[model samples]
Target: MTAGSNSISPIPVAPVGLSSRAQRFVEVDGIRVPRQDFRRHRDGWIERGIPVAEIDRAADFQDRWGGLALPPAPFYEGGPRILNAGCPKGSGAEGWSFPAGAGRVSMPYGFMIGPDGAFGIDAHRWTPLHAGTDGWVESLALAAHATRWARTVTRIRGRAVTSLDLGGYEPVPEVQGVTDTWWRGEDSLIALYRGEAVGLDAPQCLEAHVYEGLDEWGLHGG
Candidate 1:
């Protein structure tokens, strides 16, 4: 059955108001289900090493407290893939509050959407490294890569960033009329890539910036 079906197969879950159509909406796509429902479904596709929703309850962790004073300690990356990881909390309806609900996982790095890894974030936006090439094709390509990075990041907090230009030894085409606008929203950061904002492609070494630095462009290859 479609994921939005309220009738959970194993057992009845607390009232999940999402209709099948609503489940497919952009808004509900990243929400965190109650802690219990997450567990039952996690095992459904474990053979592929997919993580179950076993995370520290959102009520347990505070928001991005300590601001920059802290080490942006909400995320971690690179090794020891834990499929049954926690949810990513910061902003959004899923954040603990009046809507006191579950939507965050204690994932230090962040989250990947599909079990197959079609799209996701690893904490790096490349505005700082694409200098001199402004209004250029390489710049737009980089913009696409970075915007994709921001949208994919599960947690809004910051994370360690590492970039390497894997698209090497090959010639490429350049596209004009591409630009991006990186902004900080009341709750979440926003990227207007593609039409206005964009990101860099794979393998290009880039830098990570805090929300404060989103607007400024760093030198192209520092």
Candidate 2:
């Protein structure tokens, strides 16, 4: 690998036991080029059995691929990441703030309207219910963001929601030890949520059903 005046350029060499098409493409000179090009220029690093990390770094650059820079492909299989749906747990609503980690929220056993006008603890996930059909959600502007991350449940005894697990489709470079970093959404909403959670005031278009037999606090009945 040789460093250009601006960006890191990999010397082109022939791919080892691999065809050119199979190799992943990375941005070179503002254009997405194949891995074999690097191999052809770099003296067959693959045949030399160089460290994989070096090869990977050469293939992927930070400016073109990392930071807030737009990704070449959709980060996740589904859509953008939804940070705020505009629904607030009701007034006098039990609120709990968790550290940047994984855990589930158990609320009083009752239905509540989420900020996004959908039912259930996760308005994003239940969008289909409010949309009246899966097709509607499929066409939503931010449907990709809602569908990619796993659903967060209101019931305490059910599965938990971890930010790490509900990550973008393709892995992103970790920022400050954070797995999910990029903020992709409507420009205005993204601006509103700059490094902080944003809330929206929309109609309670759907019912957030609570699990039965649970205590007032969204916990399983003892």
Candidate 3:
């Protein structure tokens, strides 16, 4: 759907592989695009001289999709809250950081685009959430997609999570990250851990939510 001069269009059905029930689009520059698209709102990054190269790298996907407005899941509230580009902390040798959003509590940490073109959380240190912003977006999309089709969602916590034998599950490449990860099996999907644990330097906070009873369509929506 498109947006007019005065009125924003109603959110259209999410793209085929995304979850329609999980997210709605937000208006950007009077154009209705997915909330994940941060293109038009990236002026702050440019003004800060955040290296065109770095901005371009993150924009590869941010231009097309913005962050998701997902339901409460793990450490985040309303998913990764999308924000305007800003260098809350001045750019350093590590490179310029554009504040993306924050966790549910909004304290100690928030998301950002780090120097090496990675999308990560900034707290005690920069903890990479994904190799790139595109990965983060893909991760959210997958989560919503899987949850929508899963018959049962089982959330597990603590040491028990690390013990799950994912013998038949394959890692989901789109949602690539060390601490937080997604795995897919024949009839189920496993979302392991949340980045907040690592970002906040609290390993004990790890958790996993399993989505079971998903068919091929659910696993990989068209």
The TM-score leader among the candidates is 3
Model 3 bad stretches (over 4 Å)? 1-9, 12-74, 88-92, 102-105
**Model 3 over residues 1-222: C-alpha lDDT tens digits?**
321123334443343343332223222111232343345545876786656666665554343343323344444554454432343344566666666655556566777777666777787888887876656656666766777799999988877877899999899876656657889899999988657677887767678889999998888773
User: In candidate 1, how many Å is residue 191 off?
Assistant: 6.7
How well is each residue in 78-127 modelled by candidate 1, as lDDT tens digits?
21121122343332332211112112444222322212211222233222
lDDT of prediction 2: 0.22
lDDT of each: 0.25, 0.22, 0.61
lDDT by residue (1-222, candidate 2, tens digit) is: 232223423423322322222121111112212212243434465455444444444333221222111122121121222111111222223321111111123322212222232222222221111211111111221222322332332321111211123222231111111211322222111101011110112322111211122222212000
**Model 2 alpha-carbon drift over 4 Å, by segment:** 1-36, 42-178, 181-222
TM match of model 3 to true structure:
0.70
Cα error of candidate 3 at position 138, Å: 1.9
If ranked by TM-score, best first, what sequence of candidates would result? 3, 1, 2
Point out the higher-scoring one by TM-score: 1 or 2.
Answer: 1
Q: Highest lDDT, which number?
A: 3
